[model samples]
Target: MIRALNLEDLGSWLLKANGMTSDIAEVAARREPVRRFCVRPGYRARLMAAGQPVLLWVSGDRRRVTPGIWAAGELTGPALVADGKLRVPLELRWLDDDRRVHRDTVRSDGRLADLEVLRQPQAANPSFVTAEQMAALRAYLPDGCGWTPALSPRG
Candidate 1:
């Protein structure tokens, strides 16, 4: 069973999906619960660990999909070096259509305006999300949206 996430302790990250090899929208529509995400070698890859919360940001302008936070979940295991990159195991649940946080919404929010994903749109995967930004993002997620707050953001 999935446990409530302690955002404060687990922290949060933004995983970017450009929908090049695999269309993020298609992946989100899948019934699969778990996905193996690979990130290029870097410091951020080294910082990832099990249980940390992550938001899947679907980048790029797809034909019918809006680029934004499409899914949320926690890392299932620490990053593993494989094939010269890091593989992060996670179980993602796609947010409801009405619950998916849009990119424009985040860009408009003053608290989230400076999000790394916004500043470095072309940056590699695994962007950092500040505590303040996470708190702001949480406001868009309603109860039963798959994320259960287990601790205060400042905790």
Candidate 2:
């Protein structure tokens, strides 16, 4: 049932994956339970349906952060928002094994270098990525890796 997800419709977004420990990024890349919680309010509707694709960029330790794409996959189910926080159930296809990308290589590209979002990633939450940014990211992906944008249901 999960395999039915259309890759064409999945939207790409950037996430600041730094945590108190390396285990957070490790477990998430392996498609394990990564429960997120927040005690404050100001919740946004992160509408995630079953089979939706998501590109999860994981950053290692704060001391030495890698600058590259990490993992990609479809949402196994809907994202649950309880209390004052959100929990996303993800099914990720691990990208880089060690989970770090070359910062200089990506920055060399004039197109990507201009992107403030990519230049300085927010350490707080996930943000929607533009098509142009996704294109830049795809260019840096490893040879065998594939990232086809999901088609909108409306069209």
Candidate 3:
């Protein structure tokens, strides 16, 4: 299950000394360049030691009137302070070009509205998404949308 996380909401979600830890164990279990990022140093070290791959979902800023998965990235190097805050190095693959997916589409589509993660107060932090939810999100993608999978090589 992919975890739906708030990228800008730090009040509810906490990050490690370096980066955020994975809420899902499967993410840590993967190998060969985990398709994820912003992991706690310990977890990141563990994955590095195990030679695993991590996948992370970055939520768009709701305050900025943006919502939905914005991008996914693979951790590359140790976390460092950039623009004043410690940040993990990542090669990000953007999921969407525009922030069109909103509460309307989410509620209008039976597949999207059925997602349990989104059912709660959107002001909360990162939440888990079942495989069915992930599939539904993918299936709902409009034709010719610029969105791409997290694994794809970013242009």
Candidate 4:
């Protein structure tokens, strides 16, 4: 399993550090360069698309981060997700693109629903990764309207 380098919170949802660590593992597992970048006030993907060190706005239950907010450091949490639903609490570690290390834990509310894996495209054309990598990337997702697994590069 992936280990935590660090973690943060926006509301109550705590994005897993090991998740990102697993990302690093995937990079190593793939044995190639991983295009890594922190988000601005948006999702990491958009931040990279627009520019580096962009502002990121995360929405969680525990941490209610106002829009256009900025922070710099690691964050961690013990959020509980019932049946692994996204409706659980989150604690977003407030940090910037300069920092690369962070972590969080996803706890289910003892509801063992079958874990669903999905896939999509990065842009609109064609390209995808596995549900594993997709889930890993989803953990870093910022708050937005079009931000869904259907809108991302999936396997």
Top candidate, metric lDDT: 1
TM-score: which is higher, 1 or 3?
A: 1
Candidate 2 vs candidate 3: which has greater TM-score? 2
lDDT digits (tens) for residues 1-155 of candidate 3: 33444222111111121112322223222323333333333322222311112223333334533344433433465455565644555553344445334445666777657454355533222233434444455554444332222222111
Tens-place lDDT per residue, model 2, 1-155, is 11122324334544445544456555644657433322112232244445544565545553655545566655555556665456556655556555344556656777667443454565344444445656766776655444455544321
- Evaluation by TM-score, superior candidate among 1 and 4: 1
Ranking by lDDT: 1, 2, 3, 4
Error of 2 at 116 (Å): 5.6
Off by over 4 Å in 3: 1-64, 73-91, 122-125, 141-155
CA lDDT for candidate 4 = 0.24
Error of model 1, residue 44, in angstroms: 1.5
Local accuracy of candidate 4 as per-residue lDDT tens digits, 1-155? 12211112111111221222234333333544322222112232221121111122222232422222222111121112344431212222343432322212211311212211111101221112223333453444443311222222111
Off by over 4 Å in 1: 1-10, 144-155
Taking the tens digit of each residue's C-alpha lDDT, what string does model 1 give over 1-155? Answer: 12222345434767888755566667677745646788766656766776667888887655667778888887777678767777888878788778889889999999987787888878776776766667778889765433443323321
For each candidate in turn, the TM-score is 0.80, 0.60, 0.38, 0.17
In model 2, the runs with Cα more than 4 Å from the true position are 1-11, 19-22, 25-44, 60-65, 82-84, 98-100, 114-116, 143-147, 153-155
**Comparing 2 and 4 by lDDT, which wins?**
2
TM-score of 4: 0.17
